[model samples]
Target: MKANNKRDVNVSKFDTATKTIHVFVALCDNQYQGIVPVPKTIGNGQDPDNNLYWGCANGIRSYFKKSKEWKLLKTQKLDKIRMERLVFKHVSKNYYLVADAYDGQYIKKTTTDFLYSAAGLLKDTIKINKTTIGINGNAKMVAYIGHDGLMDFQLNENFSNADGKQRDAIILACISKKYFAPHLSQAKANPLLWTTGLMAPEAYTLHDALSSYIAGGTADQIRTKGAMAYTKFQKCSLKASKNLLVTGY
Candidate 1:
């Protein structure tokens, strides 16, 4: 896949003493092509105003903005890259948050290509020589929120730098646990938090999971909290909540 010259990216440091780096990647809006078909209730509903398209991404951003625990460090819009990068630091904690938003159109068979590419770019940017964040080791967490199962992509090789880094992952997408856990585990990303059957990419669910992680919740707690949040807000059947799963926790 060819790289788009137009991309928006930003980074900031909250604390140099912190040993963990959190990465969040929210893919392009739902209007992008190659979006997997979701249930009408969560996808193309009778009311267009209330849909799951980009709901997870928007929700996660809103949570950070409203929370006192997180302080905005920097915000940059790189119009040339078609991506927006937001960095935050946890108040009274040694954790830095890096969130990336891709605004370009999603290309089929190349979405993951861009996803890993963006991650690689961020990793390179945070290396000791590149930034003053004092990042001397690998990241502690890397979370991805966006469409999944629409296409297949390799994860093992893309994140080789994180091998044995004990970096946990929280993926908010349909059947993420089923489809992504194995590859992420093989790549040495431990204790993945994901879901099993079909699921609506709702913001509340992602918020809960992320909240749990911020609170130092274990992988099981993240999955449980996220499932419960989905059940409470989406009003879906209990079976939907049962679909949340954890591995390598």
Candidate 2:
């Protein structure tokens, strides 16, 4: 269904009879305007244009597609929206991954409609006719990636509709655990993995985490793998690695 903000949010069905896991990923926007700030000083300041926010979602899409474990099922690209639905099947396990990508306009808006739209999509799409381990049952997992920490107040103000689904969430944004976790947990979106400080929200960490998850890694293990991936690929310092956080196992 489409939200009032004109951004499209679509979710694929999860068949309980098949025992498949359906993952719904909402990537808010592709712009870096508000996410990475322009430096007031020229010589010693970092280039705001060098930010990776513009390519975060696309990087994730590429990471999944390039992986041998995931197969790209379909793709949709429009002026304001882009989506990719993928699947992973190994032996007796199967997983469905859906990613809905938004344009930069939504993030520039003054309203929290983007977050509301994402939450609405999550609540609408993730269902359980039976029981499964990481979704609607006992071991559900959800993740929010991108630069939304600057809109923390709006996110907290508008993000409040819970359908009583227990989920383990990973928010890969700046200070995600500090700013977004409380409200998310309060709304029944339990936090399993998150960040405590500024983060680039790179795709490798998420890719590694999902890889570990698909390989039967626990939440903590997934976090560790993600941190290691970030350090290895992104060349992050030890201080940056310490920003990764976990809660409730």
The clash numbers for all candidates, in the given order, read 7, 3
Model 2, position 59, has a per-residue lDDT of 54
lDDT of 2 by residue, 1-249 (tens): 323323222233334443333333334333333444423321111121222332333355656667676666555553333333334333335665544444434442312332333244332343323422222221245556666545543443655543444555666777766666556645565555678777667667777777777678886788788888878876876446756545452
Query: Which residue window of length 10 is worst by lDDT in model 1?
Result: 1-10
For model 2, how many clashes?
A: 3
Give the runs in model 1 whose Cα sits over 4 Å from its true position. 1-16, 19-21, 28-32, 36-58, 104-122, 125-131, 134-137, 149-163, 237-239
TM-score (all chains, Cα) for each model: 0.67, 0.66
RMSD of each: 6.6, 7.3
Instruction: Compute the lDDT of residue 155 as modeled in candidate 1.
Output: 43
